[model samples]
Target: MDPGFIGDGRTVAVAERSSLTFGVEEEFLLLDASSGVNLPVGDDVLARLTGQASEQSRHEFRQSMIEMVTPVCGDLQQMREHLAASRKAAGDAAAAIGAQLVAVGATPVAEAAVSRPAAERYERIIRQFGPVALDPALCGMHVHVGVPDRELAVQVCNHLRPWLPVVQALTVNSPFHAGADTGYASWRSIQMERWPSLGPSPYFASAAEYDDAVQQLITAGVMLDEGMVLWYARPSARYPTVEVRVADVLPTVDDAVVVAGLVRALVATVTDDIRAGLPAPRLRTSLLSAAHWRAARDGIEGQLVNPLTGVLSPAWELVDDLMSLVGPALTRDGDLQAVTAGIDRLRVEGSGAERQRRIHRAGGDLHDVLVYLAGATTGSVAR
Candidate 1:
C-alpha cells in the first residue's frame, strides 16, 4: 500500500494570511563533560528532564544523541525564547548526569561504544542497515514552517530547492570527526550521504506526484516508510508544515534562531509567489545535488553554485541573493533587523564550522572544540 496517499475526500485546512507559525527541532550529541567522548546515555538524560522539558525531548536513533523540539511559535522572538528555554532545559538535564549537551553536527571524539535504545523501530533499522546504523551518529536541525496543505507544501518544496544549498552553507557546524579535521565544513552531511534515500528531493508538480515517488521508494526497499524519505525538504507527513532538513545542528541558540527566521521568511516569500501564479523553476535534481555537495565542502568560506544561474560565485554573493529574494517577507514578519544582524555576525565570525576550526588552530585540540560547543549551546560563550 502507498502510505503517502491521502484520500480524496479529506478536507485540507489553509493557514491564515497573518504571520506563519514555525518551529525548530535540534539534535544534540551527549558527550562526557571532561573527556569529550560520546556518551550513550540518552535514556538517562530523558529521565532527568521534568515537566514540559520531558514532554518536548526524545531520544534519537542512537543513545549518544537527544533531540529537543520547540512549540509552534507565531513570531521570531517567540521562537527564540522557546528555543533558548528548550536548550537550557535539555542541557541542564544532561549536566545532571555528568554529560554535556553539545550542539554539534558530528561527534568530535571517537565513540568508545555504540548503543541503540531498546525501541522496535530502531532495532529494525539497525538490523536492516547494519554498519550504516552503527556509524558515528550525526546531528541535524529541522525547521518546520506552517503550510496550508500537502499540495501547496509540495509546490513550496520546489521553490525551496534553489535555496537549500545556501541554507546548508549557513549552518555548517561539523568540521572535525573522530578527533581529527575532516576538511569538509559539514562532515555530518557527508555521513548522511551513505543513506540510500537521501539528497535533494525531486521536483513534483502536485501532491499525487510526490506520493507516487515515495511509494516507489517504499516498494523498491529504498525506504521503510514515508517518514524515511530523507530529502533536503519535504511535506512532513505528521505535520501541516514543510520540514526543511538541510542544516546541520548549529552551535548556538542565536545561530538556530537566525536559521529559523530566514527559513520562515523564505517559506512566506515562496507561498506568496505561488499565490501569484509563479511557476517553480525546473532545476534538475542532479544539479541541486552538486550544489549541495559544494555547500557541504566549502560552507561560506569559498565559492558556491548559484542555483539560479547555475554558475560558481562567492558564497556571500549567493547569500546576498537569498536576502534579496526573501527581503519583503522578512519585513512583513518583522524579522528583517534580527535576520540582518545575524547574517552580519555570521559574516564577521564565520559559520560554526569555521569557528570550530579557528578554536582548533588557536593551540587547542578537539576537546577544546567540545568545550566551546558546550558553552555556546548554553549561551555561556561569546560569539
Candidate 2:
C-alpha cells in the first residue's frame, strides 16, 4: 500500500436504492470435539475446494473454519436466501471433513502453537500486531453495504460510531477461552482489545483526516500499512462501503443474519440522516465504552449504557429502545422485524456466555462445555 493511499478512493460504479448490496463474513474455529484442541484445517480444505469447486468454497481466513459469502442482494429476502444456502454449503463441507465448524467468538482452546492461516499477508498481520498478533483468540462478524460515493462512506463511518455498542451488545457470544472462564461475554472482544488499534477511534472530520491517521500509522510503523489498523470499525479497504467490525462471532446463521440486518439499518439510517443535512450527533467514544463493557461483562443479563442519557439501564429496555430509535432505518432497509425479534429472543433466552455457564453448572465439568459446543457446532441454535 502506498503510504499516501489511505483509502482506495473507489466510488460505487452502480449504486442504487432499489439495488442495495450487502455482504457479511463471520469466523469460526475448526476443532475435533473429542480431543478438545485447536485443529488447523485450512490447508486441506483449501486443497479440496480448489480441486472440486462443486463441494467447497474458499475463505480468506483459510479453512481452520469456513466463511460464507452472499452475493449483493436487492432485498432482505434475497440476502437471507443466499445466506441460508451458503451456510448449508459450509456445514456440508465441515461434515465431509470430519471437522465441524464452531461459531463461538473465541475457541475454548486457542493455544500459541496453532498455525497461521496460509497467507504471507496474514503472516504480516502477525508481524504488524505482534503479541496482539496471535489474536488467534480473535473472531468477529463484519458487514459491508455499498454507497454511491466515497465521501458518503466516510460520512457514514463517522455517523455510525454512536450506535456501534448496540452491535457489540447484540452479538456477545464468546464466554469461554482455553478451558477456563474468562468472564467476558465475548472474550474475543477483550482479547482483541490487546491490539494497539483496538478501541474507540478518532472521528474523522473528513476522509482526509482518516487518510492522515493511516499515513501516520504507516510512518510510525505502528501499522504495516492501512490494512493493519483494524479499529473496531473502518471504511473497507477493498470495497466502496464502511465495514462495521464491532460484533462477536454469533453461534448460528440466524444470529449472524439478524446482526447484519441491524447494522445495515444503522448504517443506512446514519447515511440518510446525513443526506438530509441534519446536524450530526456527538458520538461519545467514552460512553460507547461503558455500554461495551456491560455487553462484555453481563451480556443479556445486565444493564447497558444508554447512548443518549449516559446511564445504565436493563438490557431488555435498552434493546427495545435501540430497536425503536432505529425503526425508520430498519423499515427503510427492510430489516426491522428480523433485527428486533432477534434482539428480543436473545434478551429473553440469555447470551452464549450465560448458556456456557449454565451448562458448566449442570454437568460440573468443563469438558461438557466443550462437548456441548462441539455438538452445537454443526447445527444452528437460537440464543
Candidate 3:
C-alpha cells in the first residue's frame, strides 16, 4: 500500500492503497488464572498465535506478557474490529493453559514485585537488564500509524513531540505498584524511560539527521539502537509508520480502540497541517517531560502542562480543547465520529484508570483487578 503521509518533500499525499495503515500493539501481563499473579506466558502464547492468527504475535522482552500486533488496518473502525478479533484469539489461546490476558501500560499489581514469566527470552532480558527489570510495574500499548515516505515519517515524528502528553493523560490506567498505591496514574512511563529512549526525539531536518541522532544515542549508551530509543514518538525503521509509545494499557479492548482513533486522527491532522504550510509547534524537550510527569502523577485528578505553551491545564478541559484542535483533520480523514465519539464515551463512564482505582479502593487487592481484566478481556466491545 502507498504510504499515507507525505513523501520526502513533506507535502501530504493521498494514501494510495490504504487511506491510513495502522498497527496496534497491546502489551499484556499474563497471570496464573487461578492465582492472579504474573508469570512468563509469552512464549507459549506467541507459539499459539503463529498457527492461529500467525505472524502477528512477536516476542517482547518480558516473559509474562505477550504483545499482540494487529495487521495493517486502513481506518479506525477496521483497526477496532481487527484488534477485537486478535484479542479474542489471544485470550482463548491463553485460557487453554490456565493463563489470562490483560491490557495496561503498567500492571500496577505485578510491576513492583514482578514474579517471573515462563519465557526464556524474558529470563535473558532480565539477566541483561538487572535492576531495570525489577519494577515489574509497567505495561504499554503502542500504536503505529503509517506515513508515506521516510522523510515524512521523520517529519511527523518531529511534529508529534508536543502532543504526546495528551494521549498519556487520556490513557493513564496504572495507579498502583507493589502492595501499595504508587500515587501516579501511569508510573510505567517513568519506569520505561529507564530503558534509555523513553520520551520525545529532537527535530530531525531529514531522514539522515534522524538516523544520525539514533546512532549517536546508541553509541553514547543512551540507547542500544534505534529500537531501544522507545520515544513517545519515533519513526519505525521496519515499517513506514511512526509509533506513538505513550498511552497506558487500557482495561478493556474498547478502551484500546478509543486510543487508536485519537492516535490516527492526530497523525492525520498534523500531517495535513504540515502539508498546508502550518508549522508544527515547537516546545522545549524539558517541557515535554514536565507534561508527561504531570499526567503520570495526577491522571485526570490534576491539571497537566499544556504541550503548546507548557501552562498547567485541567485534564478534562484539555481533552475538550484537543478534540476541537483535531476536529477538522478528523473529519477530512474520515475518523471524526470515531475519535469524538470515543472520547465522549470515555468521559461519561470514567477511564480505565478510574475503574482500576475504584476496584482497588473497594477490595484493596489484586483479586478485583484480575477479575476486571478477565471480564474486560473476554467480553465484546461495550456499547
Candidate 4:
C-alpha cells in the first residue's frame, strides 16, 4: 500500500478574512570576530539561547549558520521588536564565543571543510546532495503569514508565484562569494537554485494536488520529506501559515520588518482576490524561474522581468507596481506609512548589496564587510 497522504483533512478551518498576523525567520552567518571568516560557532549560540524565555535560536544546515524564528506578530512594530530582541540575544551569545553574528546572504570567504551540524537529517542531506547541501553557508530570511485553511494557504502560494521575484530583488544583499565580488546582487540565489526543489512552486488544482506532488517527490527519493520543498513559497509544514522563502537575510532589522509587512499585505490582497472569484495568474513555471534569475542578477539596480507584463523594466518601477498591488491591504493593516517610509529610505540608501559594494570599493576588505554586516544586523550602520 502507498504511504498515507500528509495534508488530508486540512481544510477544516477556513479563514474568512486575512488575519494579517505574521512572523519572520532570519538566518545569519557566524563569523570569527577577529578575522571575519565563517566560524562554526552556531552550536555555542544555540546552547546559550536554548532555555531562554522561548526557543528562538536554532541550528541551520551548516554549523557556521544560525536561524531565529520570531513569535507571531500582529503588526510591523511587533515584528521589529521580536526580531531585534532575538538578534541581540544571539549576538551576545556569539560574542561570548569569540564569534559575531553577521547578517549576510553569503560568506565572503571559501569554506575549506563543510561543517555539518550533528542532526541526522543534515547528515542525510550531506550524503545525498554532496556539494550543494553545504551551499547554505549563505543565509536568508523567510516570512510566515497566517492563513485560515490549507486550501487557502495553497491558493495563496499559487497567487504569490509571480510576485516572488520582486520580493527577491528588494532583499538582494549578497554581492560577494569566496572572498571576491561575484557581481550578482544575490549569489546565494544562484547557489540555492542548484537544488531541484528550489524555485517558483507550480500551480496546483487543489490542496490534494499539492500534497500529492510532495508525496511523489518523497516516493521518488528526490527529497527526504515534505519539509524539503524549499519552493519560493509554500504552505508551512508546521504552522497554519504560508511561508515566503524568496528573500535574502537583509542587512537591517527595519528592512526585514518592511519585507515581512509587505508579504503579509500581499497575502491579504491575494486572499481577498480569491474570495472575489479572481483566478490566480496562469504563468508557466519556467517563466517564473527566469524572472527570479533576473531579479537575483540585477537586484534593484537593473531591469526586472515584469510578472504581469513579462517585459523588461526598471526594478524600481516593478517595486512601485508591487506597492500599488498591496496598497489596500497595507491601508487595512495600518502599515502604509511604515512601509512607504521604508521604501523611501531604501530608494535613497539603496539595497544592502549596493551598500556592501560601496564599502568594498572604499578600500575595505572582506573583514570590513563582515564588520559592516554585523553592525547592520544589530540595527546600526557601520562604516
Candidate 5:
C-alpha cells in the first residue's frame, strides 16, 4: 500500500504500519511561580493529577521534577495529542499550588539536593552513587520504539552508537545553568555524564552479552539494577522496546514528536540493516566521546565531529546527512513530511537552547526564560 495518498495536493492519511508504534517519556522542571526557581513540589503536582485520564504524571528522582509517559501510539498525531494534554494537565496541577511546570532540560538557577521518591530503589541510588546522583537537576525526553525481540534490540543499540551524538545535537537544550550561560547547548547532557553508566555503550555481540554486561554493572556496584544502565540508547528493562535517551526534554510537544519520529525511523532502519547482515558502523570511543561533547557544546549552531573520520563538519550539513540516512524508514512509515516540516520549524525557531539564549541575550533574566519555557511548553508560542 502507498504510505499515504496524496490527493488534491494534500496527504490524506499516514501509514498504519506496525513499525510505527512507539512511545515518549518526558521529564520537566517544576518551578516556583513567584521566584522562578526550582520547587520540590512534584509530589503535590502528581497528587493533583492522580485521577486524570489525560496522561499519567509521576514523581522522578527529584521532588522538583515530574515525568509524563504517553501511552503507546502508532502515529505522530497521537503522540503529540497525548503529550500536549499531559503537559496541560501538569501545568494546571502545578498552578494549583502556586508553581508552574517548565519544559526545560535543567533548572537555570537552582542546584538543590536530590529529593528522591519513596521507592527503595531510588533510595538505593542515592546511597550508591552519593553526590553524583544528587547532582542531576536535568530533564530529558526518552523515546521507545517497539522491537521484534531482545536480540534485535541489542543489535539495533549496537548500530546506534555512532549516531547518538547527532541525535543529541538535534534536540539540544539546557544551555544555561546556575543563572548564567553555560556555553553548552545541552548542559544537561554534560551534567548526565557525571553518572558512570551514561553515554554510548560498546558493541555487544548478542543479547546475552548485553545482559551480562548490565549484570556486571550491577555486581560491581556501578549501578543498582537494569534500570540504571543509562546508555544513550538501550533496550528498555521494563518494556519490549529500544529506548533512545539522548535528547533533552524539548519545550514544545511538536518538537518532541519530531524527535520521537526520528528515533523510531532510526530503529527501524538499523534493524533492517542488521537483518540484512550489514556491519555496524565502528568508531573509536575517544572519537565518539568528542563528538558527543561537541554536540553538547554547540548544538546545531556550530560544527559536529564526523563519526566516520573524526572530521568536523557544519552542524546543519551533518543533520542533513542524518535525515538522508533515515529517509527510507521515515518515508516507509509516512513520517517524511512531518519530520521535514518539524526540522524546518526547528531551524527557524532554533533549538530550545538557542531560544533560551536569545531571550537571555535580550537582557531577559532567568525568570524570563522560565516564562518563555512555560509558553512554549503549552504551545502558545508560534514555533
Candidate 6:
C-alpha cells in the first residue's frame, strides 16, 4: 500500500520501512544544595536559563519541580546529546539559585508545603483533586514517538500495553518518599494511583473509540481535559506521536536515552506488525494493571508478569525478551549497541531505585541518597 500524504503535504511514512522521530521530556526536583530538601525555586531556575534552553524548560505542577523537553530528535545519539545539554543547563540554573536539580521520581525528604505554580489550570486541578494534587513532587519521564495519525497511535497504544510493566521495571527510580522507604521501587507510580485516570490505557480498536473514551471521562468530570488522560501510553494531544508515560524520571542522561531508544523501537516494531495486519495482543487491562503494580513494587529485582506468556518470570528475563523482540528495530536505527551497553550498566549499577537504596544503606539516611541523586542528575558522580 502506498502510504498517502496527510493534509500537510508531507509523506506519511510507514514505520516498518522508515525511521520514526522521537523526543523525551524529563522532570526534575529543585533541592537546597546543602540541606538536600525540596526547594520551591523552579521559577528562579527557569529564569536563569537563556536561549533555546529557556525555551525547552518550563515549570511543572509544583514550584519545586521543573520539566525539560527535548526538541524532536531523529536518533539516539542526538537524543543523548540533547538530554545531557538540557540537564546541564537546568542543573546550572538551579545551582545559581543555591539549589540543585535532582532527577529522581520523588523527593525523599518531606516538603513542609508543596507550592503550586501560578496557573489557573493548576489551581483548578488542586481544587478538584484536593489532597491528591497537594503533593506535586511525583516526577516522571514521558517519551514521544512519531506516528502517522491518531488511528495508528491508538493501535500503537494497544500493541504497547503489554510491555508497559517491563518499561516500568527498567526505570524504577523512586524508592523513598517523605523520608521513608515506600518499599516500592517506583513510589511515584503508587502515589499516582490516587488520581482517577491512572494506569494502562484500555484497548481501542480505532481513533474514534479512543476519542469517545476520553470524551466520556471529560463528560463525567473524571478528567479536566484530554491532556489529563494519564494513561501509561496514549495518542499525543499536541504532536503526531504516541506518548509513553510509564517510567519514572531517570537519574542520568544515559538512563533516559536507553528508555527513549527502547520506546521508539517498540513503537517501530508494533507499527511494522500493524502494517503486516498482525492483530494486537488482547490482554486484559486488569492483568496489565497487576503487572504494573508488581513492576513498581519490586522493579527488576523480582518476578514480573511476562508479556510473551502471562506467567510470572524473572525481571531480567523479561527485559532480555523485550530486547530480543525489538532488536531489529533498534539495529535499523543504530541504537542497539548503545541500548545494550546501557542495560548492561543497569545490570551492574542497578536501577535508580536500587542505587538509591544502596546509597541510603551505606550513608544511613535519605539525605545521602539526595546528595547522590543531585550528582547523578548531571553526570557529576563517578559510575
Best by lDDT: 1
> Could you give candidate 1's per-residue lDDT for residues 1-383 as a string of tens digits?
11112222221222455477787889999999888889999999999889878878877988999999887777888878977888899989889989999999987887887987888888777777779888998999999887747799999999999999999999999999978999999999999999998999789989999999999999897888898989999998787788999999999889999999999999989999998999999897678888999999999998899777789999999999999999998998889999999999999999999999999999668778888999999887866
Model 1, residue 228: displacement in angstroms? 0.4
Runs in model 5 lying further than 4 Å from the true structure: 1-18, 50-55
The TM-score values for the models, in the order shown, are: 0.95, 0.87, 0.88, 0.93, 0.93, 0.95
lDDT of 2 at 5: 19
Off-target runs (Cα >4 Å) in candidate 6 are: 1-17
Clashes of 4: 1
TM-score of model 4 vs. true structure: 0.93
* Local accuracy of candidate 5 as per-residue lDDT tens digits, 244-320: 99999998988899999998898888887887999898779889989999999999888999878889999898889
Candidate 3, superposed: residue stretches over 4 Å from native: 1-18, 50-52, 111-129, 380-383
Candidate scoring better on lDDT of 1 and 5: 1
Candidate 3, position 86, lDDT: 72
| Distance from true location, Cα of 203 in model 4, Å | 0.7
Q: For model 4, how does the per-residue alpha-carbon lDDT over 1-383 read when each residue is reduced to its tens digit?
A: 00111222322122334446677889998887776678877787788874531377777888888898887677788788888888888887888888888889987776555786788898888787887776648899999887748899999998988899999999999999878899799999998888878888889989999999999998887789999999999998887788999999999898998899999999999999988999999996667888999999999989999766779999999999999999999998899999999988888888989988888888768778778888888766632
Clash count list over all predictions? 0, 2, 12, 1, 0, 0
User: TM-score of the candidate numbered 2?
Assistant: 0.87
C-alpha RMSD of candidate 4: 4.1
